[model samples]
Target: MRRSLAIGTALALAGALAFPSGAAPLFSGPTDDIGEDVELAPSSDYADLEDGELVVDLSAANPEAEGVNDDAVTGIADVFRVRYNGSQYAHVWLTHESEAVTFYAGGEPIESEATNVTLAPNESIAVGLRVDTTGETADGLLDEITVHARAADPEDVAAQGDALSFSGSTVQTRAPTETSRRFTVLGASAGETTTFDASRLALAGAAGDLTLDEVAVTSAGGSVSLAVDASGTEGARSRVAERGAEALGAVRVTVETGAVERATLRFSVPRGFFEARGVAPADLAVYREDGGELSRLDVERTGERDGRVRFAAETPGFSTFVVAADRARVRVADARLGQTTVAPGESASVTANVTNAGTAAGEQTVSVTVDGSVVAQRVVDVAAGDTANVSVPVERDDPGEYAVAVGGVDAGTLVVEAENETDAATAQSPENGSDEPVREPAGFGLRELLGLVALLALVAASLLLARRRPW
Candidate 1:
C-alpha cells in the first residue's frame, strides 16, 4: 500500500509540472459551472487579488446531500499550472466528500518528496479530474462533495500572495449495474415452475449500460426461465405504477414464429394471497390454455370436486383427457359443423363448434379449417348446453367454383369470381295456377267443345224420361 501511494504521488507531481496551465491565470475565482461559486468577482477591486483567495462560506445549516454507497469511493484529480513567485509550476490534487481519493500527476513518487506549488494572484491553471463511487447499488443516490485549492508566492504558500481559492461541485455516485436488475412478481399458486425451453427462449445479455443476473429459483436447476408470477417470488401491494420487475423482470419477453404455442404459463396463489370476488379459495393457481378455462384447475368453493371437470376423449384427429372425477361422470357427443360450401376456384375450411349439449360444463378438443386446410384447433371449455363457436379461415387456396357442405348439409356450386354473377337462370318460372285443365288433347279443339255440350243435353233429356220409369 505504501509503495502504491508513493507511486501515485510521484506521478501526480510530475503531471502537474508538465501541464501547460503552468501560466498565471487571468481569472482565479469560484465558477458556478465547474464548482461552487463562493467569492465571485470579489466584493470590489480593493479586495487585493493577492489577498483575494477564493473562499466558500457555508451556512450554519449545510444542506443535506444525497446518501452514497459507503462501500464505494469516488474522487476527482485536477492538474493546475500557475505562475507563482514569478515562475511557472504545476500542482495536482484529489478530493472526495467522504470517500477515499487517489491523485496522479507525472510518473510516480512520494507525497513527501512532491513540492506544493501555490498560484499567483489571478493566475489560471489546468484542471482534470474523475469521480467514482462504490456500493451505490440503487440508482439516483446523491452525495455532497467539495474541492478547494490555494495559490501563493513560492516563498510564502502559507501567506496570501498570488491567490487562494475554493472550488467544489456536487457529486452523486451509484452502481446502476446490480441495482439495474428489474424484478417482477410472477404470481402463482402451484409450486411448479413455468419452464421456458432454452432453445425457445432467446434472451441475450442486457445492452447499453445494463446487465442481467440470471434469476435463481429453488424449484429447478440449470438455466431456468423467468416466471413473472412465480409462486412465492415477488409482488406489489401499497405501491402503484411499478410491479413485476425484481422477480426476474425484463422490459418484455418476445416470442418468435409469429405463432405463440408455448406462451401458456401457470401460476398459483401463495399463502395469504387475496382472492377475487368470483374465486373461492383465497389461494389458487391459474393456467390459460386455448379454448379452455383460464386454468386447468382452481381452488374455489364453488368448483368443489363436484368441480369434477369433463373433457372429450378424442377430437377426431386429436385426443384429450379430463380430470379423474369427470372421466365417466359426463357423456360428450361432438357435433361437427363442417364445411358446407366452397365457391368455384374457391376453397372452404372444415371446422366444428362443440356445444356442451350435456348436462354439465366441461372442456373438449375441437378442430377447425382455414381454406380447406386445417389451421385452428384447440381444447376448449364450455358450460352445460352452452355453445362455443369455432371459425377457421377458409382460403379458396385456389381459384375456381367448388362444391362444399357444412355440417354434412350440401352447399351446391359457388362462384369464385372476383365478383359474383347473377344466378337468375337457376330460378323456376312463376306458376299459371292451372294444371293444363286436364285437357283431353283439347278434344279435337272447337269440335270437342261442341260435342261436350251436345252430350250433356242428351244425357239431361234421357235422365228426365228415365226418372219417370227409372229403377
Candidate 2:
C-alpha cells in the first residue's frame, strides 16, 4: 500500500507538471477536453455609416463523459480583441458591455464594451458589435482588416489551471466602391454663381456602395456650395463660381472615385471668356479629338450672355473641350498695274495682293481707285496663312496723270496721252515747210481731211464718165 501511494503521488506530480499553470486543465469538465470556436454571420462588407452593427456567433463545447473522460460538464467564457488601423474612421465595440471594447487610437475603453461571455457545455452565444464611422472621410479606409476573437475560461488566472482557450477572427467589413453615371456643369460666367445638379456629379452607388461625402474644387480658384435635400428623394444642387484672376487659368473640380474607376467631368465656360479673347459669342469654335487622325465634332451653342459663351458637344469620354474664336486679320500685301501709260479710250489692269494674317480664314474685298474714284472692285478670298491676288480693270478716256489706290491705300499712278497736233500739220501742208502750228477744226485730223478730198475727186470723175456715156 505504501508503494502504491508513492506511485500515485508521483503520477499526480507528473500530471500537474505536464499541464503547466496557464495551460488547459488536464481533466477539463466532463468530456475530458476543452474546445471553443467562433464564426461570423452573413458577409464582411460593411457600409461606412454613422452607426452600424455586426453579428458574431461564439461557441464552446465538451463531449459527454465516457470512460476516463468523466468530467466534461463545464462552462466557457469568450474574450474578443478588435483592432483597426484607422481608428478615426470607426470607433469599434464588441458585446453589449461598453468596457469590453478597446479603442485603437487612445487605447481607451469604448462606452459599450465588456469581456468573458459565459457559455454552457456544447452551447453557443451570438454577440453583436456596434460601429460608428461619422468621423471618417469619403475614402478613409482603403484596405481589408480582421477582428480577432479568442475563447478562454472566465476565472482562469495567469499561470494557473486549465484556461480553455481558442482563437477565431472575422474580416473587418468595408463599403463597396462607387462607380457608374457621369457628370457635367453648364458653362458659367466669371465672378458669377452658376448652378448645377450636384447629384449628377455623384458617382452611382450600389446597394451598399461607398460614395463621396463631399464635392470640392481640388486645384481651381473656384468655390463650390452644396445644397442637400433633407427629403432624401430630391437630387442635391451645387453652385460654383470663379474668383480673382483664376478665371483666366485652367481650373478643375475633383471627387473621390472610391478607388474603383476613372472619373468623367465637364465644366461650364467661365465669364469674361469672350471679353478676354476679343470675340463675339457667335464666333466661338469647339474641337475635340482633332489632333493627328481624329475628325472634329460639331459643337452646338447652348447659350450666351454678358460676354460669356456656353456650348456643348458629344464627348467620347472625360475630357476638356477645345474652345477658341474663329476670326481672321486681312491686309494688303502688294499692288501692281499692267500699264502705267496709255492713250485715250484705253484701259489699264491693276492687281492687288491680299494676305490673311490671322488664325482664321475668310474673304476680303479689294478695290482699285483712280484719282479718289473707285474705278474697279473685286472680291478676294484667302485662307489662313495664304495670299490672293485680285485683278481690277481701270478705264481712262481723258488725257492726264491719275493717282491710283487699292483697298483705300495709295498704290501708284497712271498716265493717258491725247491726240498729236504735229502729225496733223505735216499732212495738211506738206510743201509749206513751215514749223508753225495751224489751228484746225475740232475732231478733224490730217487723215480725215485727206479722206474727204479723195472722196470729192472720185465723185467728179464719176459724173463726167456718166455724162459721156450714151444711154
Candidate 3:
C-alpha cells in the first residue's frame, strides 16, 4: 500500500511540473520541469495582448509612436513586457528576422554584440521597437519577434529545467494619416483653369509653418480629382542654402487621379521674411526638388495683405516645392573692343565678359556706350560660377575719336576715319608702290621766261652794233 501511494505522488508531481498552466514545452528531457520559463504579456500602456502575443496599431491617436509620415523614422516605447518566470537568474533577449524593425529591451537595443540582459527570478522588463521609414511609401506588417531566455550561469545544474523559452508577437503598421483637400473638375474644357482653396491642407507639428492657401489647375478636359497634402520642410533650409538662396519654407505636394497641364500654387510667406533678408518680391523664386535635383519655376508676387506677403508659382508636376530668393551675383567683369580704329559707317564689335559668382543662373544687360551715350546693348545669360562674353555691334557714321564704355565700365577709345582721308593716307605710304621719293612733272616757270627774253634782247643789240661797225 505504501508503494502504491509513492507512485501516485510521483506521477502527480511530474504532471504538475511538465504541464504548468499558461506555459508551453520548450524541449523533451528526462526531467519533469523542462518547459518554457519566460512569459510575454501586454503592459499597462498597451492592452492589445491576445494569447500571450502583443498587437500594436500605429495611428494618430498614439502620439508616442512617431514617424508616421514619408521619409521619417518610427519609434514606440513599452511595446510589451518580458518577465523571467524561472527559479534562477537568466539572460533575456529578443530575436527577430525583420529588416524594417529593431527590438529593444530595458531601453537598450538588442543587437548581436549586446543581445541579453540578466533578469533575476520573477523580474520583468519593458520592450520597445524602432522602424525606419525613410523611403517607405506603403504601409505593411513587421515580422514577428521571438522572446528568448536562457540560464545566465552555464554550469548551474538546478537551472537545467525550464532554462529556455522562444515566444514572439506580430506587429502591423498603418498608413500615415494626413489632412488633405480634394478638388473635382466637372466637364472642364482643355486649357480651362479651375481653382480650389486648399487652406485645409495645413499640416501640424514640424511643418506647421507652411500653409497652402489655394491651388489652380489647368486641365486637359474631362473630369478629374486632385488631392493635395502638405508635408513639412525637414531638410529644406540647407538645400536652399546650397543653391545660394534663403529658404522661406518648403512643402511636399502630391497629385493624384489625373495629369494636369499646369498647377499654380499660392501660399503665404512669413511676415517680414523677405524684408528681413532684404529680398524684393521680384527676387523671390520657387524651386522643385526631385531626385536630388532642383529646377527653378516661374513665380509671381501676389501682393501683400494683412501684414503678410503671398506668392504664386506655376509648378511642373508635383513634388517638394520651396520658396526662396536666389542671391545671384551677376555683374560685368570687363569689356574689349574688336578694333580701336574703324572706318566711317563701319561697325565695331564690343565684347563684354559677364561673370556670375553666386549659386544661381541669371541674365544681365550689357550695353556699349560711345562718349556716354548707349550705342548698342544686348542681353547676356550667365550660369552660376561661369562667365559669358556678350558681343554688341556698334556703328558710327561721323569721323571722330569717341570714348567707349561697355556694361558700365570704360573699355577704350574708338576712332572713326573718313573713306577719302584713309585713301589719301594709303596712297602716300611707301609700302603701296615705289621705294624712291615722290617728284613733280617738268614745266616752264615765269622766272625762266623772263631770263630768256632778256638774253634775246642782249643778243639783238650786240648783232646791230656789229653790223653798224662793219659798214
Compared with the true structure, all predictions reach lDDT values of: 0.28, 0.36, 0.60
Q: Residue by residue across 222-320, what tens digits does model 2's lDDT show?
A: 111112211211111111001001011111222211111222223234466456557665554433322222223354655654443445444343222
Number of clashes in model 3?
Answer: 0
How should the candidates be ordered by TM-score, best one leading? Answer: 3, 2, 1
Write one digit per residue (lDDT tens) for candidate 1, span 37-156: 111211111111112232111112212212222334432233222211222222323333322233333333112323332333323333332223343331222132223333223565
- lDDT for 251 in candidate 2 is 15
What's the number of clashes in each of the models?
Answer: 67, 21, 0
What CA RMSD would you report for each candidate? Answer: 24.0, 22.4, 20.1
Candidate 3 backbone collisions, by pair: none
TM-score, candidate number 3 = 0.35
Clashes of 2: 21
